[model samples]
Structures are given as structure tokens and as C-alpha cells.
Target: MKVPARQALQMYCAHLREQAAGRASNGELDLVNERAGLAKAQRERIEMQNAVTRGELAPVTLIEEVLSKAGGKIAGILEGIPGAVKRRVPALSGDEIKNIGAEIARVRNIVASMSLADLRDSGAESDEDRGAGSDEVIDA
Candidate 1:
């Protein structure tokens, strides 16, 4: 059976509310807001998945748009780090350069994993659409 978009949204909202309540109980306002933001993003993702399922949008289009925004963010992070490193040191030693390079590679790997997860989620949603029809939603 396919779940309606409204039901999915309600469930997601309820889940968010529960998380927020738990955080509040723990007296963690910062954590609550951070979790709320993540919940909001998840909600948006659900909507995007629905749009893809309904043939209202293409998955590739959404993926490319998201990746472009993520690329900009990654670029900004990369740009800012070099200036910070330079400000903290007169000049970087070869070893320091190598260490920084390794750190960058590690961060790049994390970014790549995140991107891959997004792609995998989109593909899974596409498969769900094929198997169960437009309203059939799965949490990716």
C-alpha cells in the first residue's frame, strides 16, 4: 500500500516534534534547534521525492541542483581554510602541506560519502515509484 504525501509529512512532523521535545526535556536548546533544522531538511527531501514520483520533476534535475549548492559550500570551506592556515603561520612546511593535503582528502571523502548517500536515496525512491506507484513513500 502507498502512503499519501500528507500522511508522510504528518509522520515526519510528529517525529521532529518528538525529537524536539526530548531535547527540551534535556535542557538543550541548541541541540533542539539543530535537530529541527535537520528535520526540516528531511521534510523538504520527502517533498522532492514526491515530486519525482509524480513525474512533476526529474530526479537528475534535483540531484544536480543539490550538488551545485553543496559544491559551492564545499568550495567556500576550502577557500576559507587556506587563509586561516596562512594567518596562523608565516609559511607552511612541506610536512605541514602534506598533512593539510591529507586532511583535505579526508574531508573530501566525507563529502563524497554524503553525496553518494543522496544519490542512493534518490535511486531508491525511483525504484519505489516503479514498484508501488507515486504515493508509495519510503524513508531514505
Candidate 2:
């Protein structure tokens, strides 16, 4: 229809002719495919960069760090509760506290093992996006 499209059609037709004559193999076609894939990948990277700049997306590590900090705060609160458990309930003694601690640890492990699949599925909202283009890796 357009000049560039017409030229590309002509070139493809020439390649097809060469193939029909057994003068050219699919190697050229494969190269073209690879180049198209590379171009697509590069375009995606640019679009992702732009999204980050606009605060529409954030880095994985940043999200991990935020989650880690929240987890740490929760752990601190949980740890404090064990000591208070004895004072709050006077009749609770001996291995009771220890058992409670063990159960808490077990529950924590189960919760920690829970899949984060739901988080990955959800769309990142506009207002909450932060830490654009930051590649900071969380050690957790």
C-alpha cells in the first residue's frame, strides 16, 4: 500500500523466488526473524523505562525491600508478644510459653511459604509507584 510496505513486499517476493529456484535457503528468513525479535525486545525495554519514569512501574527489588521491612516489623511485634503472654495470663507456665513460641514459629513458616502469585497478577496502580529504574537488590 505504502512505499516502504511495497518495497518490503517486493524484497520478500524476491526471496521467495530465490527459494523456489533453490538458490536461497531459509537462513535469510531466520535472520530476518531474529532481527525482528531483537527490535521488539529493544522496544519493550524502552517502553518499560518510560513506564518507570512515569511512576507506572517499579523495580522488583524495591517491592521486595518494602515487603521485607513490613515483615520485620511484624516479627518484632510477634516476638514481643511471647514475653507478654506469661504476664497477661498468670496460670500459663513452664513449657506453655515454649509451646506457644513453637506454634508461632510454625505458623510464621507456613505464612512465609505462601505463594505471592496473586501479587504478580494484579495491575500496579498509578499513585503507589515508587523507586523508578532502581536496580537495588534486596539480600533477603
Candidate 3:
């Protein structure tokens, strides 16, 4: 069984103390302390090795983590957008309001007609074009 690093270091120090007290032969005590020190080093190396083997250790990259956290935060803000716009923005002219509503409905209809698989496979240009600046209607 493998010993933990701290315990191995403690054992090594204890053996040194035994040698100092003349309770063990110098050669045997030194060998025991050396093995204990090696065990401590090996234990730490194995921990790092196991972490890499299990894919729990990853390269230090903040981009993915930052984007993941920010994406959810932005999505939450967008979810309350209708209320925010109503309260904060000046009222639009009736025709402008109607145009906005129609645009939203048109985008919704396009999204509702698309297959889940197609949407999942679609890239940014395809996604933006699907719901905006296009008159192509999906044939349901």
C-alpha cells in the first residue's frame, strides 16, 4: 500500500530521530529514511499522474470558463428584455411597434419550422440568416 506524502515525510523524520538517539544502526536507519523520502516524492508524482490520466487536469485556459459563465448571465438578462424595454425605452410609434412585433413573429415561425437536428448543425451565418434579413419561409 502507498503512503500519503505527509505521513511518509513524518515517518522519515521519525527514523532520523531514531538514528540521532542511537536506537538504530546508522546504515539501516539512513536506508529507511531515504526510502521514506522517496515514497513521499512518488506519492505526489502519482497524484499528478492520476489526475492527468483521468483527464481531471486540464491546460490553464480561461476563455471557455469565462464564456460559459457570461453566456448564462447574458441569457438571463435577455430573458427579462421585454419588461426592461417597456419600462426604460421611450414608446415607439404604433407602426414601428407593429413592425417589431411582426419581425418577432416571423423569426418565431422560422425557428418553429426548423428541425432540431438542422438547427444543431447550423453555423453562425446560417443561424443569423434563418431568423433575420431573409424572406425565405420554411415550408412546414
Query: How are the candidates ranked when ordered by lDDT, highest leading?
Result: 2, 1, 3
- Candidate 3 regions exceeding 4 Å error are 1-86, 124-140
lDDT of 3 by residue, 1-140 (tens): 99999999999999888877656678545656677789999999999999989988865566558756786675565455555555575585656555555665555555446665866767645646445565558788
The candidate maximizing lDDT is: 2
lDDT per residue (tens digit) for residues 1-140 in model 2: 56798899999999888777655647556555566789999999999999999999988999889989998888887777778998899799868888778667765765576558735745753322333344436698
Query: Which pairs of residues collide in model 3?
Result: none
**TM match of model 3 to true structure:** 0.29
TM agreement with the true structure for every prediction = 0.33, 0.52, 0.29
Error of 1 at 17 (Å): 51
Local distance difference test, each candidate: 0.70, 0.74, 0.67
- Report the number of the highest-TM-score candidate: 2
Off by over 4 Å in 1: 1-60, 115-140
In model 3, state the lDDT of residue 33.
62
Q: Which run of 10 residues does model 1 get worst, by summed lDDT?
A: 127-136
Please give, for residues 1-140, the per-residue lDDT of candidate 1 as tens digits. 88999999999898788766765343445666777899999999999999879989876778789988988898678756755776688588767755665566655665565656675677555443344433336898
How far residue 88's Cα lies from its native spot in candidate 1, in Å, is: 2.6
